[model samples]
Target: MSKMFWLSCCVVLATCFFQMPTISAGSRVHRVRRIVGGAPAQVPPADDPKVYLRFAGKAAQIKGVLDQPHYVFRGIRYGLKPSGKDRFQRPRQYFLEGDIDATLYPPPCLQTIPGDGRVIGSEDCLFLNVFTPDLPDGTEGLPVVIWIHGGGFRYGSASQYGVRNLVGKQLVIVPIQYRLGTLGFLSTGTPELPGNAALWDMALAVQWVRNYIGYFGGNPHRIVVMGQGSGASSALMVALSNIAKGSISAVVAMSGTAISNWAVENAPMITAREIAEYHGCPTTSAMILLKCLQNVNAEIIAEGDTILERTRLTNRGFVTGLNGMLGAAPNAEGRFDGRSLPAAIEQPPMDDMTQGNIPKIPILTGITRDETKRAVESQYQSEIIEKLKGIPNFMDQVLIKNLQNCTHINDAAKNGTKQSGGYFNLLNPLQFRNYLKIARNNFIQGLSKIAEATNDALFNLPAFLTADLWSKKGVESYLYRFDHISQNKNGFGHLFLRGLPIIGNNTAELNDTVSHGDDLAFIFEARNLDGSAMDPPPVLSEEDLKVCDEYTRIIAEFARTGKITIDKKPVEKFSGSNFIQIAKKPKANNNFRFCEMALWAGLADRLKSSTCQFLNALDTTVKSAENLFFDTVAPAQKNIGQGLADTQKAIGNTAQKINPLNLFNRKPATPKTKTN
Candidate 1:
């Protein structure tokens, strides 16, 4: 949708393993042999009423530590261990037996840590955790939120986020664990090795929730699927599946979307072949590849995943993910004819979105102002510098390809040989060269502009495009820009990417820095990989706390009612490019990065009287609508209390105050007090 839709997954791969040293266990003991990954499950006293629950005709002795009025059930099995023979396949549902322990944090899915490439996590990891405020016995149940944790679809687990903030709002929060990397998404473009095992794992978790969430006081029909980074797009992918039909009521895709460039793998077969060859498996046939990989040690696959990254980087000259944010990710399955199972992603997300093939449910999607700011400066610095070494070649090879894809330029126009001066030939070739100069020069200074451009290409533009496309298709799509930076310098990105490289290492500028996944810090509690609370827990000032409360309230309200209202005003949907700027005090705004999006959309050359008249006309109308809303509609709402005489007086003066030049530059209207 956002044609230049590189999208915001830059941080998913780079920052996913920032905290690896602390997470990777030094001992080789299998996690399943113990009670849980972290401290042993604290069993409740013999007759504690709050420590028992029955569901699916079986009893579970749930373990929990009190956080005021909420109860958390940790390490609940939703599916059997996707290991050994079951590797790289759909999750097998695990039903609770007579008595089960749901007390400790489950082991995370095995994967290689980002920085040192050391492997952490376990293969026997397919579990979920539940957090609830109450266990109702009545017919009515609390709205449910199925949170899919984001690790660029490579790393992370259910225990990474705490539930105190959300569960306290009377929500039933279920964070489920799924397969990652090669084990989760390797495919050979055949039924013998169909990909998207991670997506299937997610679908099965959703099914588990729909079938048994009620036992924990949750309404299956009111489930809201939400996630950050890779999880965000994964949530949308799950909702689009026929398997998950009628299970998800709404979606909250925070930083990523179904159409984000990094959301799906384009060269799955090649990726699978490469992974197979790296692990010493023959890629002559899919069946052989699958069999050999199935028997290979899980750690070797996780370690060999870096081979995919190195090959893609040397071959493509880009370094964010091995392919797209991870070694293996979701892929379109419709290309194959004979499939043994239903496809999770039938086609590319952009195609599905363009065809209006989205779930008929309200969607809340958006991006952080500086989505990949840290990512570009940190994880991608060396690669970007290498590309900059040969600017012209890099531009011709990578940036130009991106430009062509975004503009949908034809082959003839791309060559710039056949066509004279025309709109299809990038309208003005000089302007394109000038843009490159600016980017190159800016990167020479620091990573700030590079980060900004990366954010626009990857995160900002895609989010806007997703909202625009979904809104056009009769879906209620609400968008927002999270601009608030907490006093503690805390954020989902900051927590995960902490202790890593910083662009300037200037703590004073934290108030201005908002990275991808930052908004989640305000809604969910941050925790260690083992589900233990942060030692010296993060502290928020009173002001920060208020913002946290407001942020969480907005999410809870959206789950309860599809409408999202910030302050007392209803947020306008993205059909008109309207979005709320979330801050200490939220305010509605329009035309998010309009000129920049236009430049990226290849409409810059057509901004004047040219071939793209329809787009120009639409742009003009959008400006007029902004003026009309503030000058007419907005004033009317404020003046209504002044009786008919005062309202009519305001309307009469509206015409004289109108000015096109000042339309786009106006700040939010300040309330004025009339003389008594």
Candidate 2:
């Protein structure tokens, strides 16, 4: 080694250097006495492997393990840490230096586990993990697939996903982390605290990829920005963003559309105030409150971020309420509003539904068949049906009100199904009365009724509308409805509310099955943080695995080429029913597509044409296209000022004592849905 290397090693290995007191930085160094019988001093194995790449006139040496056919780099910094002074602010592009020892994955962004408000993860967490077949070089590159994980915008991490399968030799996979919950999306519509920081963070990541991906064996020009669920929404938003214009070549949005009513927040300022004061940061001034939040610990911030959903108010004993029901998520930064603060707008609006700012790109979007089954709490099934029968004022408060709440994240179909107090509407020849009657009777009957309605209103309608919008514009768009119901022990298509699979008999009942996020198993090999596969590893039946293989083939192909297909046929047969129905092997129902189209979209023709004709008479006056609910579901307070004031009052007027410990640390009831 050179004299400079000796000096640097001496400084880094300070304790070892101290033993040799005579050693000098610029002098010839002599070895200290070694152990008895030592033939020669053996150098320690390099702590980690290193691979270097130069991009944008800068160089980085990444150290990742040999993950077989792929070179895997974990916890690669995609942007500067959005922590301390930068908390809640738009993400700043992370500058680079030195050997990027990206061997171990970084901690997840700070977020509370759902059900209980216990926090996990760190704030200094803006990293992307890359899995590539080719190492960083300056020659030709492979097509890139950048992944964004989904978690209702409140919580999720890059580490939660497995990218090995996605990073086939033909594709380079990069999964990135953005700020989540209060840390990421908190905003007051002020320039200092504009919302949609996560979106901006995603935009920043896209910029990073465009500038540096080529060095990592990824073609910067052939980047496919893909996201699932909230990530899907974010991906769409990124594509629509002014900053990311000409950055992304294509998109894959699974189970989400930015146009859906639940996608964007109308009142993040109200949520911010509630969060700040509830977490003990009492200040009317937005700047002071923000400063207080910056000083707060990430754990407290996580608890505070989730407090809104947990804290319930007695709204006349029917159902408890919170000031803000919607979790801390992406909100309008007032970029388009002419009168709003101009500085709050970080980037000009690009993918807005109403603004018609959608990007011109090849898009693939799809949804699971029973999305609302996940949206509706499984435990509430009995109570839902019970409340619909013979109970006074039950129809309004418990049923319709809860249905309204579901509209925020689910569907507004409850508005059509649920009946008001007066019997007059029932007596009259109302066009929608039969539809309402069928819905109410179904609600009275069992789970499937409300479940189906909510599914259509929330997941299906939004997905269909997104595809329709692109199709109407003559843009290349592929649509799919994932109907594969897994009956195996670890049903590939069925997971409980906590995301653990519903095994054995639970998987057998494929009636109202195939919950949300279940398709993930097909895309990746699920593994734990310790770099080992999960204990009781999530397995697919041979049947389900076959389906997984097919979907995987199609998705991987889509990532490779721009086209989406299964076998040799196009994924969607829009000429007939417009969507490809992906069920298990031996698709039994021939008219399943036409029948489902009628039920979910309320298509009169499909309803009339299919075997289920009794439901055809029920009217659907409001078109799914017309009922875009994302920006529409504001709860009373129209003005931001009023909402904030009311939110403050709600925070101040607390009758019950809050034991943050009891509320936060109390172990949740059995895991119902996936945690991430």
Candidate 3:
């Protein structure tokens, strides 16, 4: 009798929950508990005090909705609209007017979807969304996380991510939108229009949070700026900037950094002028160019962004001729842009990082085991193989193009190389040829190998470089590699299974590798651009949710405290050999692609001299011999060590003489005495 009575009560409650009516926007209803991963929930009445707040010397009412686990305030304008005369200008802080509605998701900054090329979004798009677990009353609040979305700095929005998972962890999450493409990053190197408006927008948003997040139960002092992909790059860039210097507490840069080869735009003026000319804008004077560009249609300028990455730029020591990778990226700014203040990114990101000019704060950065596996398979596999077949001298032509961008560090003035550009020329012709052979052979065998090479040069190496550089400066650097792939179709790799012909959205069904953006599925309950639930839903299996739980727990712990730990053990500090391998069983690992990275590092130093051409083949051949001799013969010599040690030194010195990367042996070229 007792068991039946309890069972009847449980059934009655479940029926009531399922039958609850959704409140319309205009109509008012009593507060009803909403289910997670369902339709948008309604907010409290206008008279409720939680819907109101005072910020920037004015009273404002937010139309936030109850989304089960948390309260989310969407499309709150943080900066003035960058339209009309304000186009291409630095962002100015926006204040709320009387009874302003902050409900709908703001339009994304103008950009064309990568594969479709259909331009969407608006010019008046400088808004941020805030998600809070619960509103506190006059006490020190929760640690804040300002999430910057990644779409190569062009296509992502703040609205795409539903942060119920994060907010449920007793933290506040804010996702802010910035300008993209030509409008966000076109510079003429003049006073009238200094570029990096997008960076400025980011800085201003950070400042906005520093000032106003307290009103929404967020601790301003404990702000963690986190991002993925180019968003990750932007997060690091902003954290290192003077504009948002003291505002950020910690930085979580995932899979991208400011030091990534593709992050900084080497020549902004060239791209700026091309964009100006494309829109029929006057390019004679800075003032005329700014005026004309400001007046041009925003969509026309967005379309012109394709011009930003037409030529195949050097990545470390190679060029893939892969289009759509970088488009109008961030660049260094002048100290005096006629704005009475320093530029946000005062110098190249690599320069600032190497010189230890960044903030004294903890940083968490890492990448997937295969960051661009699907990207290579989807976008450039066919093109690369076909080009190799068609052009007999294609590889040679690519080597020459890479040589032009080379920086001879020994004596830049004498070698005709720019010393200050931060281009570490990491491969000579022979070294690059050998490297190309890997890709060529992989093309014949399997494309995954080519993808591995690309990942090493692009994401993996950059991540390690960031960790190594920061660790050298005595900063607490935490690094990880997300090796866990979901059991279901919840990973970002699933997006590539069927879509338009683009790297991120490809029509290919090659789904073996854990591709780029895969970790994001476990981080946020993602939605479409229109703020609707994703079709077919990103349903997580039991195993998949375990990974998600672990991912969130690590991030949440880091946000609250400065340290990163997994399963109650502190993650190892990166000294080139320490990092967390995030898998079903998370553990510390030693070194990531050490030999390949050493090869690149050696190539950078050895290629400094003009004599690299002749020594390339000799260097490659002797290096292999040195490895064989040392690995096989050196161990045997240990038993009879004293006898062969002298002979071994002689052979090693001989090998060093021919090694192309051996810079110490090459004596300075002294001026020859003239004979009378």
Candidate 4:
């Protein structure tokens, strides 16, 4: 049968097994109590029918049960269909008509499967869901939070996320859907298609909310755009987009890297031609190419696995096909338009997109304690090692050499001498050293460069560069490193970081590797929504839960308000030790230092010194300003070496006159002042 028919059959079968409750005309309203800081308050019951929100000549019918005090609209459409001519273009304004069945979520976009066929989803997938306590008719403005889902830009849809629980917290949560894969990212570089269509989609969505969200009881001016992984990456893009400036007030990015090298180094026109040819169109003209692909069967286009596999097998040494398919991920060019937009991507050897000029808004950016380890072990470990086997000392020489090349650090010769000097050395010292040796023996000259390029492109450089950019923006940027590993070993407990034995050793050290998506369980209050407690491993005691609670509360408080410490005074002064650790027992300890952060900051400074001479000249001016030091410098320098602070002060001083519009323009240095 047809793909759509098969998909419908599968969805129907899946629904049958789950016995999902369907909304009827006469469902009773359920009342829930609101709890704050363990205190209970009365809440009204949900009692309204799903209503149609008409706007911009379109109608969006939302399904919701009105609980007294809040009319919660579950799912609503915010943008146009991803299918037909709209694919790969900026999202069009959605005009709603007829009664929309908002009670249930719409399907997600189509994606590639691993084997042969395609994963079935809908093309008309540009939709959004909103949850608010007050109905549009009665309530005034409420703070709005637009949540962007994380899936590495390849997977995830708005349907899976439910914000009913957050509605009671006195906020409106809007979960949005944007184009993914080729449809979202295909860039032609023409005025008609300037690339970054996914970002454009978000910008338009925010604009929509701004113009109409007030009717939905949301404050457009106070909207905070939040995201994780690819979603977080998209969030950063929206925050930096000139089209979206002043449209969003705050941002939250979890496990997102601002700049993507692949997007930067490669041109999208080349890939667009390939995709067009794949759809039987042989043309370089973007409009004609897009039209050709638009007419192709959606199923044929959905068969991206064929294209991805062919690209990988060819070993073209480029991230073109699948990467491009998953939306032309952001690069330096995608972020700027005549220097009006914030530079989301940071490239070394050039400080044009310096950290000093990012949007000054409240930000929450962090990485999991074992983020790298988890990333390496899960996705790259086997494939990476296998790919390097051809080279000598494949582990040490290849991996270490690769890291050094990307970071430009030349400390491989002194392996293990300074335990925490190089990123490769600190994260996986033994493996990196061994890899270096192997690469030297097996591979030809410049093998080290290859390894370093891959490593930096994938991990280290992106994280550090993003942090530097945000810190330089002069916002109240909170940095965190999650190190807690629960003790439980299986089931739902596996979500917690239970200390597991080292790969080859019987002994277990506290596994601090921030595994991918580990922070999601904590930061999102995911478990709490379904009435499930976020249980750490069984090894964690009641005290650990308390600690988790404190950490959770702190994060929630930060999300609601801008401060992490909140109304409660810090027992110790905020001497750059403002972070709270979520450990076996959550505690506010100033002694806890983020070693990775220190390393990253040092690297950022080194990069700045090598690339931007103007920043180095202004060091003294920034050092004397205590407010600038406290607000901008100290947080990044915490636990880092003194050189980091010195470099930052210099950069800050040099950047004092750097406007967001003319970041690359530098002024002549002033003579040094005499200190008698």
lDDT for each of the candidates? Answer: 0.66, 0.58, 0.66, 0.49
TM-score winner:
3
Score candidate 3 by lDDT.
0.66
Per-residue accuracy of model 4 over 1-676 as CA lDDT, tens digit each: 7999999999999988899454343342232334667656555434545554666666666556654555655446667776666666666776656776665555666655433345656777777766776644343466788888765454556655545445655577887877666666665544445556676777877887787787676777788888865677678767765667898887776655454322232345544544555556645355565666677766566564346435532442122221222224444444444645433233321222342446777776655544434323433334443444422233332333233333322332223211121222223223222112222323332333333334333343444445444555555666555556644322111232121101111122224343445555443434321123445312334554444555556544555665566337632222332444456544455422323323322333322344333224224343333211011223343553453333333211111221222311223223222211
What's the lDDT for residue 237 in model 2? 75
Q: On a 0 to 100 scale, what is the lDDT of residue 540 in model 1? A: 72
- Give the C-alpha lDDT of model 2: 0.58
Ranking by lDDT: 1, 3, 2, 4
Ranking by TM-score: 3, 1, 2, 4
Each prediction's RMSD to truth: 22.1, 13.9, 15.0, 18.5
What tens-digit string does per-residue lDDT give for candidate 1 at 381-476?
676664444233333233434433432233223434221112223333223332333433455443555566557666775676678767865767
Model 2: runs farther than 4 Å from truth?
1-50, 114-117, 136-139, 312-325, 336-351, 374-377, 390-444, 489-512, 529-532, 571-577, 584-676
Give lDDT: candidate 2, residue 89: 79
TM-score (C-alpha, index-matched) for candidate 1: 0.75
Model 4 collision count: 42
lDDT of candidate 2 over 1-676, digit per residue (tens): 7999999887889977667456343342322334566586665333334566676577777777767756777888878877778888778887556777778878878876544556777787888887877654434577788888776666567776777666763588888888877788887655556677778888888888888777676889988999877788888877766768898988888877775444666556666766766666644566776887787777777776555654532221212221122456676664554545333233322234323456777777888877656433353344444444423223322233333332332232322321111110111113222333443344533355455645654567567656655654456767777877766423343321132111111233334467667677767765543234567777677877777766766667766676766547555422223665665541212332344334434444444554656544344552221211112233453764454334333322222334322322322233221111
